[model samples]
Target: MRDFHLLIDVGNTFLKWGLFQPSAAGGARENRLESGHALLEEIPALPAQFAKYPAPSRIVISNVAGTRVRAATIRVLEVWPDAPAPYWLVPQAEQCGVKNSYRNPAQLGADRWAALIGARWLLGPRAAMVVVCGTATTIDFLSADGVFKGGTIMPGVGLMLRSLHEGTAALPDQGGEFDEYPTQTVDAIASGCQHAQAGAIERMYAHEASHVRDLTCLVSGGAARAVTPRLAIPFQYHENLVLEGLYRVSMSL
Candidate 1:
């Protein structure tokens, strides 16, 4: 079998992965093989899922879940001793065609960095706003010239709901249906949280539009479905966006 690359995106809520056959001429979409996600705690069991395929030639990872998850990821690689050392994605001043504008570039999350690269790879010179809704919501602006213009971090749908339930004594932990005017407390909480997410993205999009023409909005992550419907502007949903970015980074290496 041909050698392939393994890409992993470790977010705060889950560990997402993808297998890419770079030797394949079909580009990133066609290069992808088996891909799936598991909760952070399920990292140890990943080897079994990977066992069916031969050892990858390269393993690239973007981990924002912290040191413990990083250690767990390393341990999971014990199954493929022959695979080359994993290349952990660290934010730099510039990488993979995207320039990081963060005051301290290294402070940017690895997953977000990868997503920015993926957006550039997918969109070329187009201006875009990359919104990732997972444990947290991030709306980053990327210029047509490929410069990352920084973004906002806010509570995601789940985080907002969880916070409301935890912080308030009356609101329940579960979500209710979204409504223009929510009658029940649960529905009101759900609508407010989801709308908050959509509102932020819209505001960011409006801001980016004033400076850059023809902006594209890219949305991804687990909670994307819950928030996308509430969005008033146009958007393209990208599943496993961070994983795709990782693949793009691997290609540069």
Candidate 2:
């Protein structure tokens, strides 16, 4: 059996991973063979699935989940027989041809750093905004030349809903439909959350538009779809951006 390259992204509430196999032409092995995600609770089951395949030729990960999840992930990594050492990705001032703008690049989330790298690498010389709307919605800007200009972050759909419910006296923390005109309190809460997320994205996108022409907004993360539909600015969704970024980093090294 052909050996594989594994890519992992550990987010706040979920773990995302992708497997890449060698390509037919065998130049870059860029084609992703499989990918999946699991919420924090389901992570332990995640690594065990690796046994079905040959040991990965290499493993790379970008983790933002805190210590508990990291510890659990370590347990799973141990499951791969004779697997290569795992490469934990961190944000550097420059890597994979993307330049980071943070005063201290290491402070940026590894997931975001990967997304920026993946986005720029995928859409070379095309200026765009990278928005990841998961537990926290992050809006980062990329110049056409592959320079990462830092952006903003805010509460995502679920977090927005939770904050309102937890901060207030009566609103329940539950899912609701996004509506133009909500007749019920639940829909009102949901719609409000959507509006908040979409508005922040649009604002950042508009700011980017002010500086660049024909800007494309590249969005990802669990809540991305929920928030994208409500956005006034158009956006392209990339579910495996972080994973793709990890892949790119691996190729570079």
Candidate number of the best lDDT: 1
List the lowest-lDDT window of 10 residues for candidate 1. 21-30
- Report every candidate's CA lDDT: 0.89, 0.84
In candidate 2, what are the lDDT values of residues 1-253, reduced to their tens digit?
A: 5777888899998888888864443222257777778888998796568767777888898999888888888788888757888899989999988999999999999999999988987788999899888899888999888899888778888888888899999998896798999999999999998988888788777777887997989988888888878888787888767877887887776
Kindly list the per-residue Cα lDDT of model 1 for residues 87-176, writing each as its tens digit: 999999999889999999999999899989989988999999999999999989899999998988888888888888898778797959
Error of 1 at 154 (Å): 0.7
Q: Candidate 1: list runs displaced more than 4 Å.
A: 23-27
Off by over 4 Å in 2: 22-30
TM-score of 1: 0.96
Residue pairs with backbone overlap in model 1: none
Best candidate (score: TM-score)? 1
Lowest summed lDDT window (length 10), candidate 2: 21-30
Q: How close is candidate 2 to the true structure, as a TM-score?
A: 0.94
RMSD value for candidate 2: 2.1
